[model samples]
Target: MLVGDGARLAEAAGDLQELGLGPMGTTQLAYLDPPYNRGGSFNGYDDNMPRHEWLAYIEERLVAARELLAETGTIWVHLDDAEAHRVRCLLDEVFGVEAFIADLTVESNPKGRQLDRFFAGSHDRLMVYARNPDKVVLDGGIAAAVNPADFPHVDSDGVNFRLLPLRNTNKRFNPMTTPTMTYPLYGDPETGAVAVDPGPGKVEILPVFGDLTPAVWRWSRDRAVERVDELVCRTVRGRSGTRIDIYQRDRHEVGRIKKLKTIWLSQEVGSTDTARAELRAAGVDGFRTPKPEALMRRIIELSTVPDDLVVDLFAGSGTTAVAARDLGRRWVVVERNPDTVRDVILPRLGLTGS
Candidate 1:
């Protein structure tokens, strides 16, 4: 649940823990995108803290965040270049090196700027850590090609070019992650084509699609068979050669193609424009420097899944709450100022405390 408090974070942590959050019962993710100690005024909330002060502030809040996180949950702290390293040192002490997932540099501004002192500071850092290193889920995979040319040979009516499987010749044991990813290799003596068991006993010739990493076959047996059938349906023998229908890669399915990266771009995540649009739709708008709904949405997507409870202490314009609701996740935003929560924030969300 979201709660805004005027007191120190340590105090709030105790209060939240007693409210039944710990271990396996409730999956709690304590996400704090606090002021970057950049001396910016967040609606009169002074964020400019001295170096030592920033470190101390992080220590207190990090302690509280750790206490509030569920055993299997995680904590994602966002910061700028100014104090990312300092914050990492404190995080390393608290969350440990093994738990550290990434030190992402997010591009805050895409358009390059004219500067003489240094390169345009287009990025920020997001320190991600799992409460329990053993169970944290990570999304990883290559970016899918959107153009049909990327796939090349269309196999079916809507299918893109299919990759012929390469025989698994060199197999290595990776104990850290997927153990079942190991297999054997096979090849055709005459055609010089490699035979691979994409999954189970399914065998197919390796495509001449240039060099591919071992075990990176185009598709598994079931998938390949489906593709073959599809290809046949759309296949037409022309005077030149066999022709195949091509289809554009579906954008929505990109998330499922592979694992997700720690570094997210403004395009991948919701942008300030999208956030403003959502707020506009909800009839909530005010606080300057409000987090773009896209930014909050990306955070929510990672830490908390649908139906999970999310809490944001510095509720500000309530972008977190709005994004959480839109994603089907329940959220609570705490703002000590009653007017911000009651009049400005809650009204926009259509929620009331009475």
Candidate 2:
């Protein structure tokens, strides 16, 4: 559902709630990118509201957004240093301290904003909260960025991968705890081939600690056999001389998707400079502080799945809408600034031209 220019956020959010897009919650994610009250005026919005007034404005919108969420729904409030702390406290009051999830620090400007008085500012905050913490669904994780240094070894297929020890080093996991994982692996150190059964010239390797204490393997026998190609034998020179150990190839692509961290600086999550470049490339101008679509897509993917409803109360350049569309999520973007809606958001969303 698309709201035209002059549509107020609170009203639109209430209307969306009434629509009942889903039985659980009308929306899965309320992506709020409101004005930061940073003492500036852009094409169609004012950012110079007094502290008390700004807090009130945010409170009203957040209340409306809360009503639109389902039991498992969450909200991501985007803010800058100018009001992030204040808004976080306000969020605790509005959404309850128990509902608070996590705060994401996005490196929106790696170069840092030089206009800052004390120190150069580089990042922004995304404060997340759930309607019901017990029911909130957050199984999804973000993709980690790749670093060439981490993948120093190349495989036979010319794939870059890193070697991870097949042994489970944690003291809590060992032969006493998991006897099934305490089996021996047959390996030909010279040929770098690993097998479950020992053949002629095959060396038996047992999972053990530095003290030779029994330890468990990271994978089960069935799993290791199924993905045997991913296993390899690496020779290392230690103080005790050369020894062979079994390692699993953490291929570049296979190891990239990791748990989402608080600090986000991946190239895919573009910075302010890249976001501005994308706006310029799209021929959409006038709106200040437009977020890159990649950042929005990441937030969407983190909080909601495909077909879930995503609402952006402050639709600057319609980045949220475009991102949600690309990710196969339902979205509704609202902006009160008619000129910005006409000149930037609509054009960026291909709804109209500047």
Candidate 3:
């Protein structure tokens, strides 16, 4: 639900609860891009509130948001640095620190002027928190990862050849367990210790190890015999003769991408500006900072599977809904500004109002 006015959060929350609608269940995402307390105008509502009252306001929303979440639902609240710390503390209290997934910092201004007194503040924060700690599914692409066919290898035809290492190299080779790996790898196993095949009819066993070498092979003799047909030897042409054939058990490229981080930059998520510009073009102007569509798409992509439901509590310009819809995830937007929701956003989204 995209709400322009912060004051009406209570009413929206009440309506959702009465409807027996949860965030993931109803695609009921509550987006609260309220006034930054900078005296911004939200459909003629005052966004500026005293510090203590603001805290209460947030607490009320948190309580309501928690109730409105399905077993696996999430809520995203966007705010600037002005009150991010306070919001964090409040979120921690409501959702628990464990449920808090990300404290994302998105660039609000790319080419704006710098501040002389201090560093120029160009980014805003979006705090993502799950409703239930144990039940929350934080990963968005769970459905995509479930199907084995999605990781199909290209170019190779033999059962979709995936290049996997025969053994783990993170730790030192186990002297006892990996004794054979200690010695130089011999010829292809199909040809009985031959690394090179003289055409398809003959096998040549190259002396990769010296006579003095004494160690067990990486696999037992029987096991090696069983897997003799699984190896592929790759040979390249020209000056760069890259000769490397790979063996594999699976296609997953482990250790390629690092673990996720908290802060998110704009470049990491492309199309942020295009999304903001789309809102402006639709005449829903004056939204000083709106997250890029790609940025929001990344968040939804990580946390929700296709056909799953995603909720964005701070739905400025409906970026989350647009991204979710594009990614094949279901979404529900809650917004207070009739003009923005009924006029600009609905027409842009092609949703009919009742």
| Best model number under TM-score | 2
Worst 10 residues of 3 by lDDT: 205-214
Question: Once all C-alphas are superposed, what RMSD does model 1 give against the true structure?
Answer: 7.7
User: How many residue pairs in model 3 have overlapping backbones?
Assistant: 24
Q: What lDDT score goes with residue 60 in model 2?
A: 80
lDDT values of the candidates?
Answer: 0.58, 0.81, 0.58
**lDDT by residue (tens digit), candidate 3, 163-275:** 54443343434545565454333444443233222445333321121222233344444564577565443322334343323244444443222345565655666434655
Question: Alpha carbon lDDT of residue 145, candidate 3?
Answer: 28
Better of 2 and 3 by lDDT: 2
- RMSD in Å for all candidates: 7.7, 4.8, 7.7
lDDT of 2 by residue, 1-354 (tens): 574443454454445534433333568898888888988887566789999988988988788778778788999999998899999998898889999999889998898879989899999998999988999987447554446688898877887989899999797999888899988898988888889888987898988765566788999999998998888886767665566689998987653565677898847689877778888899876656778878988888878989998887788778898899889998877777777777777776678643
In terms of lDDT, which candidate is strongest?
Answer: 2
Candidate 3 Cα outliers beyond 4 Å, as residue runs: 1-8, 11-14, 17-32, 42-45, 112-117, 140-261, 270-273, 281-284, 352-354
Q: Please tell me which model should have the higher TM-score, number 1 or number 2.
A: 2
User: In candidate 1, what are the lDDT values of residues 50-78, reduced to their tens digit?
Assistant: 77877886788787767656676777777
